[model samples]
Target: MKEYIERVTDGEDLSLSEARTASSLVFEAATEAQIGALLSALRAKGETEAEIAGFAQGMRDAARTIDPDRRPLVDTCGTGGDGHDTINVSTTSAFVVAGAGVPVAKHGNYSVSSSS
Candidate 1:
């Protein structure tokens, strides 16, 4: 965690593997301060595609599996950090899709940068 914080603070992008490991650490071991610093640094430096993918994979790995009765499912989620005060479009879209008889699996952490 400290290594990730230091590396990101130095504006050096982590390799996909590094990002993955760091993300795993975030869920399993990193302190709130460490997570905050890492996220801030990544935001300041702008996350790369590999970093995003690796982090997403790490989160997916840590998530609990849900069986949907073998039915098709869709999720309406955003990358967040939209920096907007507007309504959450993804959340609204999920309801709309569900109302239209489609299965929706909307999920995300609370926004840290926006009102949504």
Candidate 2:
């Protein structure tokens, strides 16, 4: 993690594997300060496509797979951390779509930045 932070802070882009390793450290063993440093470094250095994909892979690795029986599902997932302080419409939209006979799957996490 420190290596990643140093490299990114030095304006070096991480390769896919390096980004994946860094993300794994973030999710598994990184301290809060290390996480913050890495994020700050990445933000300052600007994220690359490989970095984004690698981080996404790391997230997938950490997440539980839920294979729904239904096929052709609609996912209405949001981060809820946009810092807009606006009302969330994802849940309502999911309900409306379901009412209209469309399959909708919504994420259940609460807003992280502002009240909805």
TM match of model 1 to true structure:
0.61
Q: Candidate 2 residues 1-116, lDDT tens each?
A: 88899999999999998898898998999999999999999998899999999999888788766558776677888656778876677767888888988777787688877555
TM-score of each: 0.61, 0.64
lDDT comparing candidate 1 with the true structure: 0.86
Best by TM-score: 2
Task: Name the TM-score of candidate 2.
Answer: 0.64
Q: Write the per-residue lDDT of candidate 1 for residues 1-116, one digit (tens) a residue.
A: 99888988998999999999999999999989989999999999999999999999999889977667747778666645577766777877888888989888777777656555
Task: Provide the overall lDDT of each model, using Cα atoms, as 2-decimal numbers.
Answer: 0.86, 0.85
Segments of candidate 1 deviating more than 4 angstroms: 70-116
